[model samples]
Target: MSKKMGLGKGLQALIPSYEDENKKTLRNITVADIKPNPKQPRQEMDKQKLQELADSIKEHGVVQPIVVREVPDGGYQLIAGERRWRACQLVNMDTIPAVVTEYTNIQAAEVALIENLQRENLNPLEEAVAYQSLINEFGLTQEELSKRVGKSRSYVANMLRLLALPDDVLALLSSGQISNGHARALLALDTDEKKIVAANEIIKKQLSVRETEKLVKELLQNKENRKKKNERAPEMEDLKDQLQGVFGTKVQIKTNSKGTGKLEIEFYNDDDLSRILEILLDDNSHVSRETN
Candidate 1:
């Protein structure tokens, strides 16, 4: 991991926290008029958690306002504090207190990503998807993204790799059934079938992340061993070549682990068979020695 750069400079500072929102000059705007940010990286909000916050707001009221930008036509668009905005709505508030600002499209997206990251609101899968979306939509490199979000480059890169997982594994991750560590360890497996099998075992056995890593390592080692055993030796092919030359016919050799098997020589006609027999009898091959 790169050295911890405090999430406090440049674009990182653009994202407003609840405390920061409290400091800005607040404006009370109709909650219904304020629209959700199109660039918002958060896909969904937890209903139960939203209700808990709503309960807190009902008693104490909205202590910190949400931040918004003026729309070209009219009204405002949310830049951050979506959860606070939603909670106010749960309480049937007509207008929400907000701090108005101006932001470009890319700036809005950057703030949205950083805001969620700062609050730890996104799950592992959502965080990864958001990273990919920002990179795709705005053409930002992982290193650039890391600096923008104040994360290490490897942290951004590793998060992006979680997308390569199978749909089943992704579902497990999205639903909070498995952790990011478990999902990452499973990627070492090459086949979806093996990954799914491992995932099931993870859930069933209640395996920890370290246990999952060990399991996947063993599976990969076994796969490599099987591949080595299935490969044929070079000398086997050379022996088949010698047999074919001696008989002047198409020849094949098959053997078991015990080195006991059959040698096949193909002949189309009686003349061909006679020709092959003549060569075998004249040569110092095992068949001729046995006959003598």
Candidate 2:
């Protein structure tokens, strides 16, 4: 038998007794009477796509009933099919076929979130925000949340990480200047300044995701090299200060783990050099050094 197409885990499994035909919960409700879901996962809707949906609804009418919950004030708060509802409104639809169901705030929010995820309509940021909301308010673990949204655990975790990105980088992502892959590459950097700079480089160079990853790798390698070459040991600093104190002149010391180093003694003139030499000879300090 050919099965009907549906959402994550089947909407009926997610919600018990959803639109049981025998119950006769379906009705034509005034469009103005229904209110938007406060927990609508989709933050932005493309106007062109919405207009297209409106045209389709106009021609074929709503193929499925929208779900809503009647509030205490006798008004309806939409639980699912927000796009259809909005499309109907665009066409100045007076009423829509809705299944009035009894659901608590949590159930309504979950249904709305799953609907958006299954439809794959939300941008990365919007998806992250929705995931965060569910985890924060409902205390859902990533594993649990992934199953509900029909995504792998890694996908859900990666989406949550996007929330940690600085606002400007996120803006770059949200505005379509960079893709989620680009954003993931930025996450490898250790600081916000680096992330922002890399994001700008991505836009200016029009770098692809692979190129961005390579850029990030090179930046990190350079940083590591700098750290190794310029790293000043604490004992080296102490020796430099002591040498400066004894010679009455500035002293610089640099060394690596191999105990190879250089000692630079500043001198004002020949007199200063003679004084430094006298001190060094008196101490009989022996040293060997290598240039990095």
All models, RMSD in angstroms:
8.2, 6.0
lDDT by residue for model 2 (90-124), tens: 99999999888777666777778777766777788
Report residue 290 deviation for candidate 2 (angstroms).
10
Tens digits of per-residue lDDT for model 1, 1-292: 2233334364335734435644564679998988998777777688999999999988998987787888888989898899899998899988888877666676677777788887888888889998898899889999888887878899999999999999999989988889999999999999999999999999999999999999999999888765654665465676777777777789988776454789899999999999888877874665321111
Candidate 2 stretches greater than 4 Å from native: 1-8, 15-21, 232-292
Candidate 1 versus truth, CA RMSD in Å, comes to 8.2
Candidate 2 accuracy as TM-score:
0.76
User: What are the Cα lDDT values of the candidates?
Assistant: 0.82, 0.84
Cα error of candidate 1 at position 186, Å: 0.9
Candidate 1 segments exceeding 4 Å error: 1-12, 15-25, 233-292
Best by TM-score: 2
Please provide TM-scores, in order, for all candidate models, with all chains considered together. Answer: 0.74, 0.76
Q: What is the lDDT of candidate 1?
A: 0.82
